[model samples]
Target: MSRTSTESVTPTPAVARRHRLPGKALLGLFLAGFVSILTECLPAGLLPEMSRTLDTSVSLTGQTVTLYALATALGAIPLARATNKMPRKHVLQLALGVVAVTNTLTALSDDYLLTLVIRFVAGLGTGLIWPLLGGYAARLAPAGRQGRAIAIALAGTPIGLALGIPVGTWLSGLGGWQLAFHASAVATIATMAWAMATLPNLPGRPAEARFTISQALVIPGLRTILFALAAYMVAHNILYTYITDFLSHAGMAGQTGWVLFAFGVTSVLSVLVVGTHIDRHLRKLAVGSTAVFAASVLVLALFTNAPVLVYVAVAAWGFAFGSSPSLFIGAAINATGDAADVAQSVTITVFSASIAVGGLTGGLLISGLGTASITWAALALLIAAAATVIGGRKHAFPRNS
Candidate 1:
């Protein structure tokens, strides 16, 4: 994946001249991503209620998230490949349909094992959704503005974390844990319909144009980007997965929604900032986001005695993390050029796997070392991730990007 590989995929000047974002299609993708993430993390904010209702320990309940990520990681590459020749719009609609159905079933399930199965299927839906979104946004974007288009499209992740989870927590308080899932199902269904009407029905990859997972993996800078993505996502999830428990431990049990809301507000700001600067300063944004995240965790590790400090740290964390998917997937695409879709599938696989690792790691840390240790652990991982991003400047996150 040389610079020439990147240049090869750049839109011609004529195409660039007319390039403008397909706002309706991108918004449809945004909502699809929003629903997918909202479904995935809804349980985080309602863990205790879900645990009690399911007759399982909180740790075991957390595996719902882990299992979902594991399913996504396991399925992304194969599913993306399988659907390569299908209509892109149809593939998205199908995936969104599965998400809606599975989330509804999850809301109805009384048996923990049954709920796990439902969530697993939902994860498969998201596996497809994640890989498609970046490429889909790129396809719909005008020539030079693909970065901004992708930023808008992927904004749903942070929004889901920032607003969706907190809102779900509030709704669970008014109704029950199941209400969040029901809401997610309704939202997903609506998004699917919006996509059908608004999104372009692009043709899928022709056989000769398709690239394999192995081929995507072998791209020079791709593995570095994946490694950094894994580190960043795992660290984020360690804290994110068990956020409610961590808050309770820190004596902010009643402030979970508020805290997350604050995080969400800044996360939106992050998207705005990244969208503005990503195309010209991709390397700087990558380094800066990782470094900022590490610093935020360090604050979390050392300053929980003050609630204001905690809020500030968390807001910073959200700002740092909000644009990560956009940054990483963008980097991967730049690296893999014409194989951008395949690269996206591989990136999503690593991203999902990291979530699983983070959830499992967070659970273990809570059981063994306790919640306080999670921040420290996350801090260390962020440090390593930042180092990788900083050192890989020659390729992975090239300064020129």
Candidate 2:
């Protein structure tokens, strides 16, 4: 009898073994993600209080938020590489400790400089945990379960966006920005404690497979994937940063908060949808959804002023925003053969840079040009990203590479 290719290839004993992550480890991973992101998004809701406490303009305080994004982007590459030799659990635990302490410093500061300094340190620590979790998630998940595992971990994005800002604002109203950081520190510490007890070491590669940050960046598929994902990210975040302001400008001033609430819920649902579906058709999902995402951005930009149209635009953006993160995660894992963490670190480094440039430029663009101009800029980014997706279909990424 002739053997078919599918039947000829035999599975090794290691490949055939049943695998599952322990329940407690999964919870610890998700909690680590939740707190790490809260440290980023919480300050968004507390920006007004940050201004008063630091004796700066609300706009200047907004730069602190941008600073975290900037630092995190630049920091991810070197920090991720440096920690390659360390235990995954130790690196993350150390990073969280820094967050806890730095967050505490921000709470105690009466001086503006002290607050900024503490935030800067906290931002670097914040950078380390995200990619570590990516690596950790890849390691912890069973062979066929990486997507859902990552989704469960990545939910922190929307949850942080949904809970962090609103809760921080609510907390600030009751106590102050200082209290908000105190709460942040408490959360960070608790996550670290849980991680120390729960997360596996997720062993490092055989020496032959190990690569440096420079080597990782040189791979063609990895580079292209990062560029495309970054372009998509830059556009999405630029639109996201000014959404609340856009809602007000669109003449829905009183109902903007409700619009934001709608976005959060829709965004969470979108994340779940993508997390569930991406595995079966990653290429189509990345391309089609991104096209839809781009189209919605265009629609939002041109029709923002119609009150009824504004809600629809917000939900569209929310859904896209939710789906994009997981899509990018799936893309990164596909691009790098076995080093999803390395791929994740590279992806986020690009993501961070995209965010930094988008945030700073969008702020300036809004100030000098207008909100309409900001959307035009984002439209250009999306157009470029759409082109990349077209090219990617011809030269698929290294799925395990």
Candidate 3:
């Protein structure tokens, strides 16, 4: 594993001795996360409009998102490896640049194939960004606030997941699909500039200090973290991927945006709570999040006809899920120590793969079984994830750090 630089150069010993959060730098990372998700999910929200503009079927237009996820999944580790020795800030800059350029091209692309290619490149850029964000935030933080810093940096995820699509959809309605994408491009560009101005420059590690990806995988608890991550993500995506359909099935299709907004709001609150206590209660929080998630899915499975319960379940689900990146990435860094970067990369790869798994599995279940079946499947996976977390208590999610 390699050490990742956050915004700037490594802090001096005197700076490292302080006990304060670098708010601007962490928020820069937050914006990076925001743009990453906003870019990936914007297309899904505007699929019908984008399909019409590109003169393709809705299914084909949807492939833009599919290809993006695949690219991120396939490219994460390799990209992490390729850029391991580069200055952390430069790597971040390069990634932001790629995303900015690709997003602009995606907005301008009239051909579906070209849009797919542009999105794939955008995915690769995100692949590089996701793997380093937590570790980067950790390095940027002073002692005792690493978890808080991670929470702040990763908060962009749930916010983007919550607002990005709805906003993009709104933008598409007002202007067109291209306007939504152009907004993404502009956001990425602005975030890149903020990162450059706020983040310090840290030199890359020497080759001798880096460990192989194989070595990272063999670390004591890395595999367990990755497994739990995969399972949790799969469980989340199953219901999430077809949320609109599930709402439609529940006769609340018109409330899709509001439901997601509720989910997002709770998720942000979850981040705040998790950030405040994560360093002291990592294991307890991780286990509780999984359990709550499972419980929420159970409610969804049994009470689809109850609109009030549905909203409550979705809100609970979001709160349970909101701090996951902070929890999992924080755990991985704790487990692998110096190999945190590699482990983060591996964790991200699994996370992306799980998205594909969840989507495919959800589609299969919905087509053959019904939207109701997806909730049960999500419950089963959540149970597995919870089991792994409890069972790996000694190393993976140790009670004491």
Cα-based TM-score, every candidate: 0.93, 0.89, 0.95
Clashes of 1: 0
For 216-244, candidate 3 gives per-residue lDDT tens digits of 99988889988898899999988987898
List runs of model 1 lying over 4 Å from the truth. Answer: 1-17
Runs off by more than 4 Å, candidate 2: 1-23, 206-208, 394-401
Which residue runs of candidate 3 sit more than 4 Å off their true CA positions?
1-17
Model 1 lDDT on a 0 to 1 scale: 0.88
In TM-score terms, candidate 2 sits at 0.89
lDDT by residue for model 2 (1-401), tens: 01113446677777655445455776777787778668877777788778887888887787767778778888887888777777778888889998899888887876666777777788789788778765567567776666666766666766676567777877898999889889989988888888878887766555566766676666556667777788888887777777767766777767856877878888788767876655565666667666777787788788876777767777777776776666677667766666666778877778777777877778888899987887788888888887786677643432221
Candidate 3 lDDT (Cα, 0 to 1) = 0.88
Better of 1 and 2 by TM-score: 1
Error of 3 at 279 (Å): 0.9
lDDT of 1 by residue, 112-192 (tens): 999999999999999989999998888887666788889999999888867766777788988998998898899998998
Q: Which scores higher on TM-score, 2 or 3? A: 3
Clashing pairs for model 2 are 336-401, 337-400, 337-401
Candidates 1 and 3, the one with greater TM-score: 3
